[model samples]
Target: MGPTLATRLADWIDELGLTDHLAAAGLPSFTRDASGAPSWIEADGEPLSDERLAELDASLRDHGDDPAHGVPVALVLLARKARLRAELLATPAWTYDHLAEVRGASLNATRFWVHKQAEEHHLLTVAQGEHLLVPAFQLTPSGDVRPELLPVLEPLLAAGTDPWDAWIWLTQPAGLLGGDVPERLAADPEEAALVAHAATRLAQRVTASPKPRPRPAPSPVPPASGGCGCGGHH
Candidate 1:
């Protein structure tokens, strides 16, 4: 065998530059057991049991691998977790039930409103387990949706921009807005107009540009002759 699972996984983690990220997330660090097999130790020094390790290994295998890129498909899945979710997982957010209670509205009514608003791109909602989470940044202190934020959100939504990407862009500082975070900028009536204009321009630019496609998977070997399509005729 080439590299054992422990060794390969360690190298891949380093290659992906996720060591700090994993640690920040409280994930167990990978290591070799006494028998030189794969093991993990939690932050509290609790060892991951053998049975749990086997289950994790099985899950990783089931996630499959992309032979084309030599990447464990699971790793891609981990890294591609909607950018908003990755960055804002710990951000203050409210679930439908919580919003319903706060608004004194029925859960069904709240759900309907949230779904409609989110679908219209008037709200930022992130999928979390069995529920959708609305980050507090888009809401008033009274738990009501910030109507001012809606205009800024509309351009991105109307442009068919992915909600996750829009969420990240809105929350990040934008040079166009003099490094003001769009979400915060939208909180001010005077500044919000600027943010809306910036958002509209951004949406227009994204719409006018062609998205980059993934690089084609490399071929295993040289083609034989005669302009083979696959680049591998062996």
Candidate 2:
């Protein structure tokens, strides 16, 4: 099990060198007791201001999403949920008419594909208010749907993520893609295959349990040598 929010907060306080600031604010130090157990913060006579709580809340929210900072999975999931909600809200919604126009296809044809091929082909659409928005990134410059998209989309949809959420997963930088966003990298066939494979793994993870798996460990940094590792520096 990971540390509690209080423990994390206390750690952050020390990590950020905020001991003096907290003291000046008349707040007790968020530190461990001599026995290495958690010590709760207590106000020194004066009540803690709402401003201080708000600041600490925001700080906890940010660090709670980061594993390196010892944030628990629960807080991390909360942060992720907030971010997904925001992404869905900020994402632009396009009408069927607009979608058909962008694809250079008749409305009827577009509707057929959206209704019929969407599931099989991995086309994503989201309902916003009264209209369903089709994310524009799914298409190539040639106005045809990117053939490579379906493979990645299939597993994500099957994994129970909504279209918008699936799209977010595709567009975000994937470690499996060597830090390339899946949507952009889909143009290259070899990379697209890898992207699709990675998407399947993500699908498995999404479907495996209600609780989110732990976030992937951060990549290790290469040690710096005096000269460039390549002879080019010579």
**Per-model CA lDDT versus the true structure:** 0.71, 0.65
Q: Model 1, stretches more than 4 Å misplaced?
A: 1-84, 209-234
Per-residue CA lDDT of model 1 for 1-234, tens digit only, reads: 697555556556667765445544445577655865645666566666766554544554464364323544545555555454667766677888788777789999989988888787788776667777887788887777789888888888788776667777788878889988999888888888899999999899889989867545433667667757573000
Of candidate 1, the 10-residue stretch with the lowest lDDT total is 63-72
Task: Indicate the worst ten consecutive residues by lDDT in candidate 2.
Answer: 225-234
Q: How many residue pairs clash in model 2?
A: 0
lDDT of 1 at 29: 73
